[model samples]
Target: MSNRVLKILVPIISIILGLFVGAIVMWMSGYDAINGYIALWHGIFGSSYSIGETIRQISPYILAGLAVAFAFRTGLFNIGVEGQLIVGWFAAAYVGMAFELPAFIHLPLALLAAAAAGALWGLIPGILKATLRVHEVIVTIMMNYIALHTVNALITTVSDGSYKIDRIQKTASLRSEFLSNLTDFSTLHYGILIALLMVVVMWFILEKTRTGYELKAVGFNDHASQYAGMNVNKNIVLSMVISGAFAGLGGAMEALGTFGNISKMGGFTGIGFDGIAVALLGANTPLGVIFGATLFGSLKYGANNMPNAAGVPVEIVSIVIALIIFFVASGYIIRVLLNRMNKKKEAK
Candidate 1:
């Protein structure tokens, strides 16, 4: 089979296996697997409200997936997207609350602030990895803690000891009354449009730009790229910065679109971590990430209905997602099986 076909087949096969195994688990636990899945489907698509909220959930996942995928394509492991996202959230929220500019200026400025904050957060690890040869994973992991505590402190300072920040100005908001009404007053917003735009942006950058070529070349082999006159260290820094900017935009989607404010968190949001799975399932491609994010968003959002509708535990859905990720991670085995099957067909 062709590489393109294999790329498509692998994720589909993994998802099927995940569902199959999930059904088995449900059956063993004395629950009707089919009914659970029916409930799941209904939860995701039953009402316009469900569809709107699912799309809303998917908006951030798309950007987060792109953040991880961009870094993966550039040979960087950016565990700091969570941290970058936090800082971006804080920056956007602060700008939205503190400034009183016109909609055009205020909104753009808030978005820019978010991207810049994330880029800055990513820059530290990028610089360390490029110049000092420190591992990006290590630096980014530390950065997450720093970003969390620092942002929490900053939020308290800005809010006068309150854990919550003020809502953004309406002009700077991404909320859409038209979309909300269209979707039965769901918290749907224009962030999905922004997310789609970023998808195109990521694709254009990686597939049609000189900087992308350099980044990919550096990712493939820094020594070879250096020999070919590419600036390896510079590309590394640039890749991380771009990846971080995507993650920051994800945070802005939440602050400006979904919640309209920022609040203290007891723990990580897990969006960045989930982005890792999304990237893996997507094969590190821009368009593929959309489908991956959609699948994840559907499963996650729909899981809420399993208990009420079918008496199935929500944890079962988590297990299914985990199994799907596991199977995706084992793609080499799937490839080997496919190759063997192809050989058998050829022989026949």
Candidate 2:
């Protein structure tokens, strides 16, 4: 198969394999696979409210996926999108509460604070990787723990007893009454626009810009990039910074659109972790990430309803998502098949 065709076919096949595996598992577990899927569908598509909720959930996933994919394209494994997101969430919330500016200024300021915090968090590891060749995976994993604990402590100390911060001022919010009313008061907001805009921006940067070319070249072969006069270290840092900024915007969406307060994170937000799978399944494309996020979002929204409506364990939904990731990761198997086809054609 051609590369373009393979790119499209791989994700589709992965999705099919995931659904098939999920059905087999359900049948083995004595669950009604048909009913389970029916329930899942109903949960995701039955009501306009449910549809809106899925979109709201997907908004952050898209941004988070962009963060992981952007880093991947630059040959960087940013396992710390979680950490950057945590810091950005806290920073956005803090700015929202600390300031009393007009709506136009306050909202932008709060969101910018989130981006700045994420970029700074990413910059630490970038600098380390550039200067001392420290391993990013280890550093980012450690940073996740640091961000979690620090945010919890800060919130606890600042709250004077509560584990959550005060509700953000209206001026800093991304809430949209029109969107909410359209979906029977779902948490849908203008942040969805921001997410879609980022998709376009990421595509433009990766596909139509010189800087993106340099980053991709570095990712393909750092030594080659160096030989071609690309600044390897600089590109690495730039990639991480941009990736973190994407994650930061995700945090801003959660803080300003969905939830209006910062709370103690007893654990990591799964959004960043899920983003890794999203990025892989998306094949590191901006448009692909949006589609991947939408799929995951449907599963997430439908998971809760599966148990009550179909008597299937919610774990089944998780299994389906995991299977999708597994298939995506094993995409080299598809390439082998394509290679065989090419060889046969050449022989003929």
Candidate 3:
């Protein structure tokens, strides 16, 4: 089969395999797998409120997936997206609370603060990799802890004594005023629109811009890029900065649109970590990320209903997601088996 066909078939097959495995797990645990699945579907697609919640969940995933996907394209493993997200959340929240500007200025300013904070967080590992010849993975991992503790301390000591940031200014919050009728007061906001716009922007930058070419070239081969007069170091740093910006924006969207505040003790939310899965599942493409985010969002929203309806554990959803990722990543084994079966048939 052609690579393109394989690409299309692999994820579909993996999803089927994952569902089968999940069913087996449910059966072993004394639950009716079919009922569990039905509950999941009902939660995700049954009502307008469910659908809106799914979309809200997907908004952050879209941006976080883009962050990881963009870094992957540059051959960088950005494990620090979690840290960047925390920094962005705090920055946006702080800015939102500190300012008293009009809605237009406050909202943009908060978002910009988030992007800047995330970019700065990303820059640390980028600089370490560029100047000190350190591996980005190592630096980013360390930075995650730094970000977590720093944010925790800031929230605990700097502002309100609580573990959460103050509620954002009304003007800074992103509301679904226009879509209120459709969403039924779900916290689904304009962040979804922003995420979609960023996807288009990312696609355009990666496919049609010179900087994108340079970043990809460096990722493919730093030595070759250097020989070809590409600034490999600069590209590496720039790629991380851009990746962090995406993640930061994701944090901003979540803080202002959904949470309306930043948590202190929780530090980096798992959204950044989940982004890695989303990026891999999407094959690191803009369109792929959107689909991956949608699937994840649906599963997450659906899982909430399973516990109430079918006596199934919500954690099963994570297991199913893990199974899907595992199967997809190991698709070559499936391909080899299929090829061998085909060869035997031809010989017969």
Candidate 4:
């Protein structure tokens, strides 16, 4: 099989294995696995509301997935996406609330603010990695904490000690009444459009651009890229900035579309962390990330129905997701099996 075929088959096989194992677990626990899955399907697609909400949940996952996938392609492990996202959320929310302008101007301005904030946050670690030989993983991990506390303080200061900020004005909102009515009044927004656009942007950048070539080359080997006259350090920093911008756009989805406001976070949102699984399941490819995000989004949203509809705990869904991740992580085994099968076929 071609490498492309292998890439597609791996995730498909992983998802099937995960579901199969989950069914076994459900049967062992005295639940009807078939009923559980039936309910899951209903929860994801039974109504217009469900479909809208599922897509709504998927919007941020797409951007977050892009953030991690971009960095991975550029030889960086950006663990700070959560932090960058939080700051972006704040920046977007502040922009939306602090100013009033035409919708065309206000909305794009908020998005740009969010992206810039995230880029700045990412820049710190990128510069450190490029100039000081510091590990991005360590710096990004610590930066998550810094982003959390700092954003919380900023929220308090902005809200005069309140825990939440004001809702965004109409001009800055991504909500569409027409879309809401079409989806039976779900919180659907234009964020999915933005998410889809970024997917294309990522694809174009990595697949068609010279800058992307340098970035990927640097990621493959800094010494080789440097010997070939590429600016390794610049590429590294540029990669992080772009990755951070994607993550920031993710925050904008929440700020302008889902919630329309920023609130104090008592703990991590888990969106960025989930992006890790998304990137892994996607095989770190742009189009692959959308498929991965859809699976995750549908599963997560549908899991809510298991308890009432099938008498199964929602935690089972989590277990299934974990299983899928495990299989994806062990993709080398799958590749080996495929190779053996190909060899046996040749012998015949």
Predictions in order: lDDT: 0.93, 0.91, 0.89, 0.94
lDDT of 4: 0.94
For 185-295, candidate 3 gives per-residue lDDT tens digits of 677888999999999989998999999999999999999999999999999999999999999999898888988887765445788998898888888999989988998
For each candidate, what TM-score against the reference?
Answer: 0.98, 0.96, 0.95, 0.98
* Tens-place lDDT digits, model 1, residues 229-313: 9999999999999999999998999889999999998888888888889989999999999999999989999999999999999
Model 4 lDDT per residue over 284-313, tens place: 999999999899989999999889999999
Taking all chains together, the TM-score of candidate 4 against the true structure is: 0.98
lDDT of 2 by residue, 137-168 (tens): 98888988988899899888778878899989
Count of clashing residue pairs in every prediction = 0, 0, 0, 0
Which parts of model 1 are misplaced by more than 4 Å?
none
Lowest summed lDDT window (length 10), candidate 3: 260-269
- Pairs clashing within candidate 1: none
C-alpha lDDT (0 to 100) for residue 238 of candidate 2: 91
List the candidate 2 regions with Cα displacement exceeding 4 Å: 338-348
Model 4 alpha-carbon miss at residue 283, Å: 1.1
RMSD of each: 0.9, 1.6, 1.7, 1.0
